[model samples]
Target: MISGNKRTERFRDAVAGFEAAVRAQDADRSQQYFDDLRRYFGEADDQDFRQAGPRLAAILDEMPAAPRATVAVLVGACVERGADPTPCAPYVLAGLAGALDDARAFCDRWAATGGGDFPDPQAEEPPEDLLDRVDPDLAVAWLTLHHWEMAAVALLDHAAVRTALDDGTRTRLLRTLRSVEEDSGYVFKCLAYALLVLDDEPLVVLDRPTGTGYALRMTGIGDNFQLHTLLADVLIGGGHLPGRAPSAEEAAVCRDRPGQVDTIGSFNLVTPLGDWVWNEGTPSDIPVVDGVRLLVLDPPSYQRSWPAGRFFPHMKGDLVLERVLGADEARRLLAGCAAADG
Candidate 1:
């Protein structure tokens, strides 16, 4: 039986050999190298192999220097294993930069060999220009991972409406969306809200009155006001009325009628309130008083300028809280109106 150190050394050698074969474009050798790796890593289900899987850094060290090709391989591997690629992004980015440089070099060589008929491929093509030559769907796949919205939009624009995405590409895109969604909390909902506006999806007022302005609010998750603000901006950017940014009237109302708007939306973070209101009964049992059609509740534990007494009643009893309001009073007031309308 191989000692751990010996096994690790063997793995490293196999990885180096595999990468070299890939660089040389020797298919038979590459296949053999991969077969060795697979066997060493063990037949997928081997307990020892699973427990002793190589670190990401080790795997990255063994990958070919060609960025694009290596990224493709890594992405393919991730899809095959049903794993997220986020942990590997830094490595992927490094590889992509190398691949892009290699592409430039290859273009230069091609033009030189073609005796000046070919355009100088080394010229820094506008991202738009690059979009023209590469598969637009693949470009979108990569750009999406980086949250390069403008590039992704442009790439998707170039893609044929009927173009089919490869399974790997589709999975990567979904993973990217999920990552962005998780990072930005309500961003996906904001985007959906924006698309709804575009599709003429009628916004219904929540239980609140039509003239009442409402905002979606969440408890602060760290110093992450920027994420919340960005989400709100995305919703407004979608060209909808009563946008995420409070209009003058809405702002004025929040300032004048502080009692009507409940600030703080989500309970994801550990606020001074200690813990979240997990049981629906805590929120549902609260009575909704008249004049305030929408009552905003803070986590019962949060001690702030907004007294818990004002909103807690609305959350109790059979009343089901339809929408969450953010900690920003102005925004919550606005989103409450928006939710009601939707």
Candidate 2:
């Protein structure tokens, strides 16, 4: 049996050989090296893959020209075997730069025919003909990455690639992706929310107490005023729902409740006296009740916010939320943000 160290060394050697072949633009030698890399990938345990993934990613980063077909195969294999696909993102994005026009055109045609919205590839399988209609290289990358929004989000990350496209083309692609993003029931929902909350903190309510809830302070990303967005963040980033497990820290802090806390389900923003500050359709000119002002954060959902409706799969019950920021507050916040920027 090959010792772990020896196997690791061989994997590194294969990566180096692959990089050298790519640098020299040698097709046959590249294939031979990639075969060895494939064998290593096939045999990699979790520890081995985590260690090797970064190295492979580093090589792909340096190689101006890579064997796109083999790279797709390797990335696809990584995702198929239940390993992280992050390392493959650079290569996927590189290929996507060339395929964006093709993807955008396909999406435009699909929308014209009333295809509606795109689904999360992880939670829901895409249509059989979907990949067939796209550029072959783009389809392969998506197939391996197991995401439709991957290309769109990847394009956003690569500013050079994104700006190279004509403004009209970029806008069309982004608009299509945004529509798909809104309807998705999984991680993409979190991503959409992140985009919405860019450069501004949103509110989030943590429902530990049964009657009154604890509102988390707006500090950083993932902490949003919207419960759905916060829940989406929890599900995507932590790989677990908030209701499923109570934090030991939360249990310690929530002393008013003797038993375990239930933090899931629909919530309402209320005052200290348990009066409705905001829930569902509360209307615009929300009066300052009892001399306290509320930080209103009612962003649009898959549908309008009212009477609590079901949208994402991660939710246990319906959610009824308040209205968006009022005109004065919006101006004040934006002005403050601008001043900070200046």
> For all the candidates, what are their Cα RMSDs to the real structure?
19.3, 12.4
**If scored against the real structure, what TM-score would every candidate get?**
0.26, 0.43
- lDDT tens digits by residue: candidate 2, 147-185: 324333432332233334455644454454454333332
- Candidate 2: where are CA atoms >4 Å away? 42-55, 58-101, 109-176, 179-266, 269-342
What would the per-residue lDDT of candidate 1 be over residues 67-157, giving only the tens digit for each residue?
3343344333432243333334334434433333333343434334442232222233425444444444343333333322221222222
Instruction: List candidate 1 segments past 4 Å from native.
Output: 42-342
Best-fitting candidate, scored by lDDT:
2
Task: Tally clashes: model 1.
Answer: 48
Q: After superposition, how far is residue 32 of candidate 2 from its true place, in Å?
A: 3.2
